[model samples]
Target chain A: MATKASRAAARMMIAPSVILLLAWMIVPLSLTIYFSFLRYNLITPTGNPFVGWENYYWFVTDPSFQAAMLNTLMLVGGVLLITVAGGIMFALLLDRPMFGQGIIRIMVIAPFFVMPTVSALVWKNMFMNPVNGMFGQIATSLGFQPIDFMGQIPLLSIILIVSWMWLPFATLILFTAMQSLDQEQLEAAEMDGAGSFSRFVFIVLPHLARAITVVILIQTIFHLSIFAEILVTTNGGPGTASTNLTYLIYVSSLLQFDVGLGSAGGVIAIILANIVAIFLMRMIGKNLDA
Target chain B: MARAVSNRTRALNTAVAGTLGFLMFFPILWIFILSFKTEEDAIRAPLEVLFGSGWTLDSFFTVQERSDYFKHFANSVIISLGSTFVGLLIAIPAAWAMAFVPARHTKNVLMWMLSTKMLPPVGVLVPIYLIFRDYGLLDTRIGLVIVLTLMNLPIIIWMLYTYFKEIPGEILEAARMDGASLREEILHVLTPMAIPGMASTVLLNIILAWNEAFWTLNLTAANAAPLTAFIASYSSPEGLFYAKLSAASIMAIAPILIMGWFSQRQLVRGLTFGAVK
Candidate 1:
């Protein structure tokens, strides 16, 4: 009876939020699904009659879709690689005895808190600008012609900026996890003649496996929809060189005012996100007992 | 011999680590220095002008004078705090339910909540915008707060629930057996025990809400504009003033940066709490 009463209470407590999300999710998704079949544009509202997947057909055939898809994949994959790799190094380094480690940690952690727009703006102007940016200055000093970072390699620049912003997160997680490891085991390994690399591989890396997965999964979710940096710096430009799926949706709905097509693009993004999420969730589920 | 070997390795590690840390932070540090430069000096080749010109607060003054710093700051404070509190209000009960009296679908429910977060806001953005427009809720602080709260609620609840779960259920059961009401079980017994978790959740949510740019930028115009929008406005192709732009960027981000510096440990803890657990 107590269990039943608690179960009912749980249902009651969660009901409002669940119902709200239900409407929030189903309404837009169903509308988007319905709109995907119609010739809908925000500018041209007369796309009322359903055209049987014509919108999807056009969206799939459009050259920008492939670019957007690849860009999204590259952005997500690229940042994850950089952040996770750099993060492990930083985390390990910070976990050991070092001078001014506190101050160094603070400096490293600062970028995570910088507003995305502000960070992007600073990078675009003070750091990445071809004429006066720090990068340009360094390149010139090194006897190499200044590279317009955004113009020449727009996606890579964005990826680097994001990696910087998120590396702290990965480091923090792995560091926290590393700190929690049993020190005796590490000393034991040392006493038994395990080299640094062997200890790191056998002990530290295993300890960080869950943290690494978390970093990858969480970052993937957020990075997939990265918009602020791209908007502030590149605006998906030099001709869609840096266009991601989210920006594509933005251009369609907000820029072109094509509601139907925009909604279609949105649905596609949702499906893609779900696919990534499903893979991540399955991995997490498998690792639950580990 | 062993001490010498360890010392040499340690020295090598420190040198490498220092360089990596410096590289990671150089852009932000350069931006801070550039914010104090004159427009002309700001655009000078970094090799020529860094630590070259006399530092001045003139850019800061101009940025403040040009933009209504207080108004934007106030809006940011209210929206971030309002949503975090509002989210806490709803999340407390929900988290309590899930943490203490979880149903069969508790993990599923939590996963579902988080999955909603993964859905690109653009997917439902048009409908929400239409709803907001039709209801005359566009560009209103209250509307922005609600949206921001909704946006961050799942993670807030997740974080709080994770915190709450660490509290033994037996404690709550004991309180109930003492003739305590449900509220007393939660308020008197449960919440107090979970203060650390709750505090971390609040701080983490505050940072998330403060840093949130997408919904704030899209839903807000002028009256409801926050710092994210303020920074976005600085990137006009015509201005070409890196100094003022960097100054504005600093102004827009300083409050949160200060807050984050203090709570960095707590935020990192909350973020990694569930992942490792």
Candidate 2:
């Protein structure tokens, strides 16, 4: 048991981290909230007079806003769909007794370690280039015209790249969780004449429910602000085809120098992230006690 | 695992899973191969590039020569390691305090810290950019170190707390009963035990900060750019130089890739905040 003196010392020890994180969250965030209310433009910095929700009005009503909102949802949802489903399949496959299990796992998990910028650039140029990309060579050899992947299907192309990066993460988590499955129970069910499909549906899937939820919520949080892939591959272009909320705000604030509008978009992004954060926090918090 | 598995079934599993794994790893493997070829050979049809191209180290040399690659490499090293060490310094005492002397509000404090991590970086981009501009911290490695340190502190604390929780408290109690001071107990008895957890935490944090793209991209231009920013410059027309781009990418990712393989187990535990484990 901690004595009174030790408790005091504990408080002292914990102060720096608590204070720094508090300020880290509070200072810039409050400034963002403050700037969102003003008509601040870096180009015309004569005055940043407070404009009551005008930035929000313009931001939300902008046609690109609708597209960006949809794109963000699609990117996050598509990645989640692919990663979760692919992760489950990979986890199941890897769970089976296979040859070179260690090497197979290392190969499967390698993509997640590649920096986002490297992965994006490599995929864009090496694999996706219409004329010279590997896919192009394959298509041309097969007598089909090569499709410019980033140009023709920017969002889908972005999704494919992002899914490659994340599939490893989802698989690694699900696979780890799968290792904890009750093998005797599975064997018993098999002996009771349950088919493999029924065994998976009744037993394995239920066990992985928590890990799957963790994967989705965590991936959603990261996916909502995917910046590097879009910047490198698409630059949110082909007429804003792949522009998501994060890139939209990036363009407005940094590129266009519309601090007010960008800050407003930033606020909206924060709100959207908070909705997911609530669920994630609840899940992880429950685990803290366990 | 104890039960008998047929050779046919094992072979089939190998075939299916190996194919999938190769597909998953194809991009990296392809790039690795491309990095060793001439630019002319790299863009040729896949079969020719694989079978016909003469291997060369020219691209790697050109990539290093044309760009100041090592400058960015050094920046990546400093920023990731600097931030991790700084974060660990701040987090160790806090995590220890919370783990060993948790009070009524410890859980809420932890949950609040995690909630801060959930705050999207974009939400505060404007102010942070402006502040960095005014303070002349923009494009500075120290600025990134500070930002990333704050960004990763919560996870560091949470991870250390989880690891510390696993070390039985009764040992400390026994030491205290033996007339050991609290400092002595921690330094003599606890520090050695905590090293492995701390090392893994350091490893995972380094991997994260090394690959961190958002702030590294936005905050830095040339002076403090890391490999993420450096490699991003290839997004220009130069990206068409397949051999050179592949070479650059391979160099950038290779170190982290090796570290990642070693940390795969810790990666799951670290990212999930011990939720699944």
Candidate 3:
């Protein structure tokens, strides 16, 4: 029902955001693609001659790159497994009538708000330090050797830290979805002799399917580029044990000044992210009209 | 929805959920306790540290004195608030337009905006770094503000759009039918209605921008480092000083944590872009 004037006004109002985003997406991306094909190094700012796919070959073939790729997959997969499972458990429990639910929820959600650096440092020093950490203290009191968490299992340690931060996010989303579930339908199933387990499996799980998908897609996007947690805790560690694609690119481009290799890695990271993004975009797009 | 359950079951459920919640919150609580203890006491065994330490505000003072903490805190406040404010300025009109006057491509525009957010920052790290260096915008607060503004613009617009979508169009139609000009219609009728949504959007974005680590860590050095970068500096030898690090961390996260609690409901909607709801 908008008039010609309002439609024109809408176009005018939308121009700045559209133009800015278009530029924001285009300029740097094209430069990254261009740079990926050249032999560019920031430190030695000499001739940057075009080189075809060599940077990609080297970056992909490098031993650290292989380790980084493995670590990235493990980190993302591990955290998703923990957070999603934990989130389901938490949502189920929280959905039940409980005492002090608000306080408990605040406590649970608090970690997600803590900045990555703070949370990483807190976990690293206060809770995981082998010499003086809480876990070490507990281990020693129980007459066991204190495990060096970051040293022995850097990727696992990161996954735990990240999981703690994100479990709340998944729980909150799932819990919100659960509130919309038909309680009477659940009751009717119970009346029809469905056990609690069967009811949960058949009714609640299906209802939660969409919310779970939303959680997985959104968390994957954030999880794929977990940077500060690794930076502050392990610095991609004892030997790139915890290095993800983002950290690997950061090290090469910013630290090593191999702009070409970093750009190539950046292009690959973009491509991988887009593969996930297409799925997410499709899901969100379907929801737009509804 | 409240079932007729026994008190024993309720109590059992409460205890289990409470314990799990406490475990999740333990690290933050531990740091809070550590922040108030002396450096020596903070490193003691967990039980000993809890039982034997005399509480003091020394570490908080020391964190302030040692690193000029307020400068970084101010930078964080400015960057997050400035970016959110600038983002709102650009987003309000766009969101309003899209919600009220959407055409054929409006949904495409929104989905595309979100797609930009998925473009991992690492993808353009090289060019952005080079551009910032060349333009002398590498370590400036204004530069950080601009980057964060663009970084968060899509989410800001999406959130405002979702919120705006809820406001009925008939209200605007009524306002226009009263011979109100477009400016008067927005200022008198729409802005007031949009204020609460805008406030929640502001709250969520500020929390996001404040805690954003990647750009703040990479783009800023000493002069313009926000709390994220400032806290990251503690990763070295300074990190060994447990009480000081805890104090610094508490200071950095406290404001956002409180804001987060208040905005928890909006967060699900904002982050998921209204899909779950």
TM-score of chain B of each: 0.90, 0.98, 0.98
Model 3: colliding residue pairs: none
Report the error of model 2 at residue A115, Å: 0.4
DockQ class, candidate 1: medium
Lowest summed-lDDT stretch of 10 residues in model 3 chain B? B233-242
Question: What shift in Å separates residue A212 of candidate 1 from its native position after superposition?
Answer: 1.9
Worst 10 residues of 3 chain A by lDDT: A281-290
DockQ of each: 0.53, 0.84, 0.84
lDDT of 1 at B133: 84
Interface RMSD of each: 3.1, 1.1, 1.0
- Candidate 2: lDDT of B139? 100
Q: Which whole-number lDDT from 0 to 100 does residue B30 have in model 2?
A: 91
Using lDDT, give the best candidate's number. 2
Per-residue lDDT of model 2, residues A125-237, tens digit only: 88898988888889999999998999899999999999999999999999999999999999999999999999999999999999999999999999998999999999998
lDDT of 1 by residue, A66-178 (tens): 99989999999999999999899889888766666777787778789888988888888778887778788888879999989999999999998888889888888777778
Residues A1-290 of candidate 3 have per-residue lDDT tens digits of 88899999999999999999899999999999999999999789759998899999999999999999899899999999999999999999999987899999888888999999999988998889888989988998899999899999888999999999999999999999999999999999999999999999999999999999999999999998899999999999898888999999999999999999999999999998999889988889999972
Cα-lDDT of candidate 2: 0.94
Please give each candidate's TM-score.
Answer: 0.92, 0.99, 0.99
